[model samples]
Target: MTKLKVAVIGCGSIAKHRHIPEYAAQDNVELVAFCDIVAERAQSFANQYGAKAYTSYEQLLQEADIDAVSVCTPNALHAPISIAALEAGKHVLCEKPMATSSEEADAMIAAVEKSGKKLMIAHNQRFVASHVKARQIIASGELGRIYSFRSAFGHGGPEGWSADGANSWFFKKELAFIGAMGDLGVHKTDLLRYLLGEEFVEVAAFVEQAAKENSTVDDSAVCILKSASGIIGTLAASWAYNGSEDNSTVFYAEKGILRLEDDPDYSLIIDYKNGNSERHSLGAIQSNEEGKQTTSHVIEQFIGSIVEDTTPPICGQEGKKSLQVILAALASHDTKQIVRV
Candidate 1:
């Protein structure tokens, strides 16, 4: 069996904790290169993996012989780096939010089309066991028309999760684009879209920098969304949950209520209107802490897609749709009115 050569761009916390280790564990993958603007960071990862290191991503793309590259840079660089990697004839697994804006997302899709290579967004929430099961149950019509939902993703802040700590680029609007909405909220946005199997058609939002000091971007956000089929929901993203992380979602359907990631033991709990309940102990959701490494099915699915010559579960277009909701939310905040997604 031939091994797929993989390189990681931006040796940051996410790449170190998730991408590199996950790729290393894959029997069919050979970790080939590591790239970062900081030479020592890239060199450190390369030394650990016995791969080449480059301080310049352009040089790495030009020199490395790899089948795929994971773009784990700042949110602003996702589109440019992924597009370049795609044009260089390598498949790309870019971390979300896929781009800072929809126009950039479109450009990324164009590059994927031109290259004829796979482009998967690292929307890891979609691969969560509980979320996957919810999607399956919903698709089976067991939920009986999800009418509304309330989803949230919050933690102390990115300062604890970013490799640079308090000095992380995540607080800079130029790099992160939107603060909580881009960092944590987008995860919920993507997850809800995946779970509901519906696209949001309208959004109204209130975004603010309510918690983090010295931050130019929003630290908290609340968005009201309406799907095309008349499903309504609320999405809240925040960096002010100092007590504990709250990554939970409650789906209200005609028959019952479905709760995800809300319990300590069961990841999913379904309470039916018929006075019955179901509990599932599918594994816990991954934490946003810096050094914690958790099992993720993202790499396996990405590699499988390449090997089987199929589109990835979260392709560029699918990522774009999820991103559209976030972008629309931001627009709504800016204009103080509802925005069509």
Candidate 2:
């Protein structure tokens, strides 16, 4: 088995904690290069992973032997960097929300088409055990006609998570574009669609900066979604939650209700009208500092798809759908109307 040569474009926390480590863990994936505008950061990441460092992405992309690259940069640079990698004939796995807007995502899709390389978006939530079970239950008809859902992702703020804090790119509208909606909301949007196997056709959202001072983007958002199947739901993503970490989803169906979350325990609880209740714990509680699942599974899946010439479970095209929901929520927030997804 020829190992895939991989390069990481951003030496940020996500790339450090997730992408690079995940790729390094894979036996058939080699970390060939690391790139970041901050030279020391890139150098440190490269040294940690035993890879070469480059200050510019162009330098990394020029490596002829690199087979794939992970674009872990800010939301603004995802499209351009991923498109460039795809055009350079390397498979790309970009972090979500795929880009700031749908047009940017569309251009990435175009580049992937032209380059004839696999492109995947890293929506790690879909790979979590609880989420996968939800999909299986819904797909197996155990949920019995899914009608509605509630999903949320919330935390304190970016300042606590990153050394940059409020000054971090997450707080900047130009870098992150949107706040919690993009950082947290996009995960649930994609997960709900994946679990229910439906598309979010419209969204009515309320986004605000409730707690964060001097924040240009939203700190919290409550969104209502109408899926293509006419199933309606509410989603909340916030950076103002004064709790530990909150990532949860509830599904309502004609037969029963399903709960999926990881805080208290990795459990799926179900309730039926017959006064019967069932609680399930899918014990894969390996969460990162940000409470993200061990995303190494997702990275491996993407690499496998490229190796096998098969579509990834969450390919770039499918990844765009999740971002579409979040972006629509932003539009709905701005207009105070239902925005089409």
Candidate 3:
């Protein structure tokens, strides 16, 4: 078997903790190159992994002997880098909030279409054990129609996780575009779409900057979404939850309520309308917190899709649909009125 040579862009926290290590662990994948704006950071990883390093992704794409690349840079760089890799005839596994704007996301889709290469968005929440089980239960109609849901993903700001602490690009509006809304909010948006398997039509939200000092981007947002199926709910994403991370979602339905990641002992809990309850002990969700290092299976799926010549589970098109909702939420927040997706 010819191993797929893989390269990782950005030597930051995400690349350091997830992309690089995951790619190395794959039997059919070889770590060929590493790129980072900072020469030292890139060289450090390349030396550790016995791969070549480049400061510019353009140079890396042209010089490296690789079959695919992972765009683990800041939120703003996702689209451009993915498009570049696709055009260069290499597959891409891009980190989420896939792009800053719908226009950029569309261009990325166009690049994939033209290049005939695969592009998968790293929305790992969908691959979580409990999240996958929740989707199955909802699809089985076991929930008896999801009337509403509230999903929230919150944590202390990225200062503790990024390569540059408080001075991280996450707090800057130019590189991040939107703060919590882009970081944690987009994950819930994608997960909601995955669980409900429906598109949202309208949104109204309050995007605010409240917690971190000297931060230009919003630290929190509360959005009410109305789906095409007439289901409505609130989605909250925040950096203000400075205590401990909260990655939980609750679904209110005719049959009962399904609580996901709400309990440490039981990851999924179902409360039946007949005054009965069931609890499930599915595995944990990946977290940025120290020692929270469970495999999300995103890299495995991406590699499998390529090796098998199958469409990626979360393809560029699917990612675009989720990004559209986040764009709508931003409009609703700015106009102080409901916006259509």
Candidate 4:
């Protein structure tokens, strides 16, 4: 089997912490190159992974043998980099919050179609053990028609993840767009969509700059979504939680209420209407030398898609659908009214 050659753009925390290590672990993929505007950071990644380093994405895209590129760059650069890579005849795996706007996402989809190359978005929540199990339960009709629910993803701030802290692109409205909504909300939004197996029809959102001494964008947001299936839910995301990472989801159906969380052994709890409760424990994805776990599942699936010529679970269009919900929530926040998703 011919191994897929991968060039990862951007050597930031997400790239270093997840993408690079994940791609490296796949047996059929080679970490061919790393790129970052900060030359030294890219050099460091190259040294650590035994790959070449390039200061420019264009230079990396020029590699004749490169089969795929991961867009681990900031929000603003997502579309441009992915489009360029796709046009250069390489498959693209872009990080979530697919792009800053719907238009950029549309352009990316067009480019992917024109290039006839695979495009997958890194929505790792779908691969998490608990979420995968939750999806299974819903699909099995055990939930008995998911009617309404609520989900949240929150953390103290980007201090631990963003090297530049308040000055990080996450704090800048230009680069990161709406702070918590894009950073954290996008994940929960995507997870919700995947679990419900429905399309969000419209959104009404309330976003605020609730934390961080001074910031142009919101630090927290709560959104209400109406799905095409008539399911309703509230999605909350925050960077000002001032607590440990809180990622949880609850589903209320005619049969029961199902819940899942990151903590407490990563299990899904179901309370059925007959006054019975069930708990399903999920096995965690084994970690690699770098401690990267199931988040690497996307990399593995992407490589499989390359080899098998099949669409990965989270394809480019599926990614954009989730992004559209986040973008609509932002628009709703600005206009103070429900916006069509």
Candidate No. with top TM-score: 3
List model 3 lDDT by residue over 1-341, tens digit each. 89999999988998988988888889999998999999999999999989999999999999998999999988989998999999999999999889999899999999999999999999999999999999999999998988999999999889998999999999998889989988888889999999999999999999999898999899999999999989999999999897989999999999999999999899999999999999999878899988888887999999999999999999999999988888998899889999999
lDDT of 1: 0.92
Q: TM-score for all predictions? A: 0.98, 0.95, 0.99, 0.94
Candidate 4 lands at a TM-score of 0.94
Instruction: Tell me model 2's lDDT, rounded to 2 decimals.
Output: 0.84
Q: Name the regions of candidate 1 deviating beyond 4 angstroms.
A: 290-293
Q: lDDT tens string, model 4, 1-341?
A: 67888898988878877888788788888887989888999898889878899998988888636999999888889999999999999999898888888888899999988999999988878887888889989999987888899998887887667646567788778887768888889888889988988899999999889787767788889999999989999999998877556778899998999988734674688989999988877765333223434465778877788888998788878988988898898889889899998
For residues 1-341, write the lDDT of model 2, one tens digit per residue.
78999998988878877888788889999887889898999898778778898988987788646999999888889999999999999999998889888899899999988999999888888887777777888899976888888888888887876645667888888888888898888888888888888798999999998888877889989999999989999999998888677788898898998888844854678887677987778765334455554654778899999888998888778988888888888788788889997
Angstrom error of the Cα, residue 184, model 2: value is 0.9
TM-score-superior candidate, 1 or 3: 3
Highest-lDDT candidate: 3
Query: For model 4, what is the error of residue 176's alpha carbon versus the real structure, in angstroms, after optimal superposition?
Result: 1.2
Separate clash counts for every candidate: 0, 1, 0, 0
Query: What RMSD, rounded to one decimal, does every model reach?
Result: 1.2, 1.7, 0.8, 2.4
| Candidate 3 to truth, TM | 0.99
